[model samples]
Target: MTANASRAISWGEASARRMERQFLARPAGRGTRVAEVVAAMLGAHAQVLSAAEVSVGVRAAGVTRADVRAALWDDRSLVKTFGPRGTVHLLPAAELPLWCAALTAIPTGPSPFPPDVRVTEEQAAQIVAAIGEALDGVCLTVEELGQEVVARTGPWAGDLVMPAFQDLWPRWRQVLHRAGQSGALCFGPNRGRKVTYTRPPAFDPGPVPEEAALRELARRYLRAYGPATPQHFAKWLAAPAGWAALLFRELAEAGAVEEVAFEGSGAWVAAGDTEFPGGRVRGVRLLPYFDAYAIAARPRESLFPGEAYRRALAGGQAGNFPVLLVDGVVAGVWHQRRQGRRTTVTVELIGRRLTARQERELGEQVERVGDVLETKAQLVVGKVTVGPHA
Candidate 1:
């Protein structure tokens, strides 16, 4: 923190600066590598893999969904795995070691399941190891992997204890994410419609050490979405608030971070990351479902101001509605429906008005979105129906 810095940065300016840092206010994400975009944003949320590709594509110039898949499966530059909050994400493959160490270092809470259904710590470790061994040098569907895991361990490991969708999941399934966070598992190319799992490409971040890995991860988050607090980070990682607060204290004592006032509240930014961009970030962008910026940015009220505060969020969660961003704030909600070779983009601008020039920019942005998805996009100013993706 700059000692007695002149003035606190307003929430508006802070939001604009974050846009620049996140590559939203600049040229299509400043790099060609899909992994580059993934790293900058920490990870692309991948519960919907196609949406994940859009999250990356909109950030980078000339990149497409195929490019994201190539990085994941062909070039192996991006690894599909459980990342922050144990949600499916596409993380930079080379950073798996660091990601694994930092993620595994997060403090965990007690299980939600009853004792009869719960996976004990010893059982979890054993199952994780079995998962690693079963997927090494080969790709296997969940059923096939379950067979191998049961064979390697015991039938007790395969007891259907966890309820998922319409069926029950095996006891070992609880550790599936742990296996990925331990760098022993990742996603593989789909065999037709069936998904497959495989081991990471044999790189480990153990040399970085957990403490160092965590420090770097903190710095990365601050650099991309900073002037933030540990609570925001804790929420992003689903880690404990106390654990996150302690981490910030450590960073502060080491002089790796500086405190600054953000909207009158004290926040920390990475050391030397003091420059705030001048003027508002003027642009109209249609961000896809689960876009990192929508999910990770701080001060939700400011990000989703006015009517946007209600419409853009679902159950107090961001990323449910595809956002129509105007000058770094959520101004509306949009939806994309792709049929064959064309994508129809329906946007409802709320809470703000646009100039003629800004409206033109919105049209161009819609066209760029089509380019990202490799489809011809038609823009319509109307209500966006929120349901399953069309």
Candidate 2:
């Protein structure tokens, strides 16, 4: 049988099972950050969270900077986790080599740059050097650092310079990676707040075999977000769709992964037996803006429906509500407003008929937020509604 056909899982069942397992495995005390939990959840959803939905997920998951910091240490797990699309993410540090391997060709090619955006090697070098010098001993914001590079490069810095910088961000990230390697940049104050860059400690600058990297990436992708189609992985990784298919083929042949069928959809899962939690799910979480649960799945409709998905994912769009997930499905949207010592949580559902238990659960969640934020929370429930003003 084809690999994809061999390892598929029912999406909802897997999601529910994974969520239960995670909540139960939550580390005690201030040990693991909510970010790590969120990462694990998304990894369970499969290794990619969308750049758009991450913030919400993080907040809802109650992950903080501290949690994210702790999780970045697994080199193969973390570095490649972020920066897949000029946006940042938390990846398993051990999987970086694989992600970098898969993406190396994309960043190096001519197509990554539009025709209007011209950045010659010399200009790039100058910008890099200026940035390196300016950030050598100080931690500056992007705007501050960019201005310095702009002043040094003059008009030749190009019109699409910011995009170019974004394009070259990974290369620049490598500089920080180098710094991290030399111990020049370790995890600063708050999960890399003090460090000039957000990347974790770097690896030795040595050649990594391309095949091995690809294999590892494929394996991680499957392990974390298995029962997923190759298309799903491609979308999550922001890689060319064909690349995902090829990689899956290579890994499956190596006996690193298998396929499963879930709810009529086909996906791949990790090779070994997986365990999950057995319990009824209940909770109304207010996810942070960049939480992993929302971002990891591509096409989003795989989890959320069509128009709802569009409104949420589209950029320059507002009023896409913060989601309230009930039983692993989007039940309503929530919003939080902070006023001095009080935080008001507003819930607008697609339906007003929430079970009494669901309402109580939601109230408790709001209270939990209040406790965490050290503010009194006012919970307001409203009807199902959508609009720019809603």
Clashes of each: 2, 55
Residue-level error in angstroms, candidate 2, position 78? 9.0
**lDDT for position 277 in model 2:** 33
Per residue, candidate 2 scores C-alpha lDDT tens digits across 78-104 of 442234443344544543444455544
TM-score of model 1 (CA atoms): 0.95
Best by lDDT: 1
The sequence of per-residue lDDT tens digits that candidate 1 reaches over residues 1-390 is 233344687766677777776667874544568887788889999988988988888778888888888898898999999999988999998998899999999988788888998887888888899999999899999999999999988999889988889999988888888898888899898999999999988775345689999999999998888879999999999999999999999999999999988887999888978777655688888888878998888888888988888888887799888899988889999898889999999999896678999899999989988987899999999987775233
Model 1 stretches astray by more than 4 angstroms: 1-6, 29-31, 204-206, 388-390
What does the lDDT read for residue 191 in candidate 2?
29
Q: Candidate 2: worst 10 consecutive residues by lDDT?
A: 44-53
User: Candidate 2: deviation at residue 143, Å?
Assistant: 5.0
Per-residue error (Å), model 1, residue 361? 1.2
Question: What stretches of model 2 exceed 4 Å from their correct place?
Answer: 1-8, 21-30, 33-82, 90-116, 120-134, 147-155, 158-210, 273-282, 305-320, 383-390
